[model samples]
Target: MKKYTLLLLTIAATVVILIQSILYIKAGASAGKTSGVPAESLARLSEQVSVRAARRGNPWINLRDGRDLVAELTGADQGLLAGEGLAEPMALASDDFDEDGTPDLVTAHRAAQGGVLSFYRGNVDAVYPNAPEAKARKAAGSYTDAPFLSPGRLLATAEPPDLLGAGDFDADGHRDIVAAARGGSSIYVLSGDGRGGFPRSKQIQLPGRVTALTAGEINRADGLADIIVGISTQDGARALVFEDLRGAIKAAPESHALPATATDFALGDFVDGYETDLAIASGSQLLVLHGRDRRSAKQSRPRITSRRFSSAIESLATGNFTGSHRFEVGVLSEEGEIAALTPVKVKSKN
Candidate 1:
């Protein structure tokens, strides 16, 4: 008899929880309808909930309130390399530098001669035995001979580059190195010779000090990749698009003034379009410049949208960060918190 009473109480409590949940949802719906909450706000709230559910299984980040910022923590506590004589690491970039189907890492450190680039090769075979590169290389009997640090090679720059980026800037088959000099108005494009060497570097002068650097096909008609740089002048912050013409950069770049001083920026397909857009972070505000399609007029400016955050953003990164088909923007806060922002769906005016 006592056991039966305890079981009844457990079921009763479960029923009460379900009842309260339904009531709470209904009350929220009623309040939303009566309190004149904007449809966009409701849509954002619904999307936040969806984002949380989608990211709940991710082991790296703790997406507590979906869109809210939280400090990111990793399981490992040890460093990758130690006592390598690297001083004051400034920027880092990564890509498959060798075309060996393994992603490599490049870190820039402050050096006496400007910035030093450290190349760390990726070991796909050792790390992932079943990876495509591993299988193909094994089948062909072509194994990597050396470890990550390619024995006697060192890359250095003339100026201390605050921002580092990788892309085929000259439309060459091999990817090249791109860096923006800190506190200076010069952008360097170091051409990769495809055999683990940078043969030459081209310097492009900008209007002001470079704050950020990124590469994309901003002007699709050119059939080449262009470099977009964020600059800060006495007037304000601005974005410049330097068109790549037949493996050479244009002397005069097209510039657009930003609303605020950009701390960092990235280029990605953030909105519902095939064209790449720009995401800029200025203090606590996030501004997006929507890219124009091929059919649009060339002289028209991009449509910009601004969103304010509670904390100041330190930097901006572009990727499929939210596990969505379209690329989203991930921001790092001054307090070391991380958050993601995706394109929000809105009703068409037509």
Candidate 2:
């Protein structure tokens, strides 16, 4: 009986070891596959797959089958902005304005019309009627007829306003406009007024030139939108949080100084299970500023996660990529190299 029991115990231990060996082999294979491919190539391929799938009106597709494989343009000259006539497009925003399931594209032109913010309602249809051959196309003409708030008198001056953001700032259903003028160092809050047109409201002045601005619901509430403004000066760039109270901007407690030269900021859920955090792009680096707990008397500074990049980052946007939350930092250099960063894995997890 003792010999039989020993045999059974040995077999069970062998089975456990076999299972672990199989898991390690599977994990190593996945790591090898990912490591063999360059990050840039992976990013490009992922984008191509997404675009191709999107054009087919089916964003969700099984990667294993690969039946819907289609050739995609990975070059910068690809007609992503065909018929848009957008010169030096610096900033891009995506939102579902029409309550449609898909989001629309809004591009901010840096040169044309002296720096106008052009809103293009992205058509989900694979073939845009205007550009039947192209997958994506921009709407015609200026959505906002007036000149963007800047120092110059040009109807569409692009002096690079201190800040620009789009959200329901005034608690209205429609997305209102919010811009900070570089010359005046003031924040202009526009109210939707429950109508289609936005009426300009009071302009609040800040200490320095606004470099970046973003809107998000940080407190997990729904009444008004929260504004995150990055101010750049000779000293350094600092981020300020303001509560949008029906067109009036009030400073929030999260307003604090940061280390780098903040250029453009974005709000999104960085940590999978935690609340949204502010991601700031400073020069060629991206920094993640986690929200602070107000209850802590020790006064812990905002947690900063820095990631280096090859090119100078001009702007940033945070959204879900491959079902995991990620950030797409836009680089505005002559070299068209755009990259997205995902969470790095630890060796202990393996």
Candidate 3:
């Protein structure tokens, strides 16, 4: 009876050890697999939320919705909102307005006095920038998706401005603004101080109704930016190039005539390897002034080459949005809708 009882006790110990060993192997196998949700699910979620950003070498030209950016800048004000307002985008430019590492937007307000230079500072370093992050942070008792308008100051203007232009006018490694007044009485050249302030206003007298205004290194050798404006005349539209002669600014005694029926114009290298090419949107035609030099005392004019478009282009924004190192022209309709047009070399009749 004692031997049988000892054997029974040993058997019970062996059974408990075997059960523990089976549980350990099962737990190890489970640990080897994912805890919850699979890798494929995460990839699908990423695909649903994100888009393929366009990078260099592969050009993707499509209409992108800018309402979110606009809303962040002007909460309730929709007057200057692009795609809604006809003359919404007076000037669309990017710069580090707040001296931040990321670039910010500088555009006009759609109000009557909108030309006073409205700046939308970049929100690159925001805490709760996305939806998921915002939701999580909100549950944790703290949440913020930080501000787009970072301490904006409206540089006082005499009258409402019709057009806004920017360049390193002072050549002080900072961007200076050139605003053409709506009344055609004054053209204000406010020099930027790297901070979002223009203490002094160097107002210049205008010749006539200037439709468009922009700045570029019109004088190649000088390497300093010069102010260029489009003048509406009896015959047609004209390009009035003004050179920044250090302190004071000087323009051609007479305005250079653009292509037939020129409505608006902007300075850009529309052609590759050419600098300061004039791009004029005349009615429904896109004209490029190739191999032109505006620095000459003897009336420097651009050689006009044009392409016909389906609809009239109201304004021009020149930049490399298509991953091209060279500049691409973004045309806006009267309705403020924008579409990018890439430049191609066209052979003229010899």
Say which candidate scores most in TM-score. Answer: 1
lDDT of each: 0.64, 0.49, 0.56
Give lDDT: candidate 2, residue 80: 33
lDDT of 2 by residue, 179-281 (tens): 6544446666655443223445556677777767777765334445678777876677777777544432544435556666676777666654345566777
lDDT of 3 at 260: 47
Cα misplacement distance, residue 241 of candidate 1 (Å)? 1.7
The 10-residue segment with the lowest total lDDT in model 1: 69-78
Indicate the worst ten consecutive residues by lDDT in candidate 3.
40-49
- Ranked by lDDT, the better of candidates 1 and 3 is 1
Residue 187 CA error for candidate 3 (Å)? Answer: 2.2
Give each model a TM-score. Answer: 0.65, 0.51, 0.58
Q: Model 1 clash pairs?
A: none
Candidate 1 vs 3: which has more TM-score: 1
After superposing candidate 1 on the true structure, give the runs of residues whose Cα lies further than 4 Å from its correct spot: 1-86, 127-149, 219-224, 245-248, 294-297, 319-326, 335-338, 344-350
Which pairs of residues collide in candidate 2? 113-156, 114-156, 114-157, 114-158, 115-158
Q: Once model 1 is optimally superposed onto the true structure by TM-score, how far is the C-alpha of residue 254 displaced, in angstroms?
A: 1.8
Superior by lDDT: candidate 2 or candidate 3: 3
Tell me the spans in candidate 3 whose CA falls farther than 4 Å from its real position: 1-92, 110-116, 123-149, 182-185, 219-223, 234-236, 245-254, 259-261, 292-301, 308-312, 317-350
Model 2 residue 139 CA deviation in Å: 24
| Model 2 lDDT-worst window of ten | 144-153
Candidate 1 local lDDT, residue 134: 42
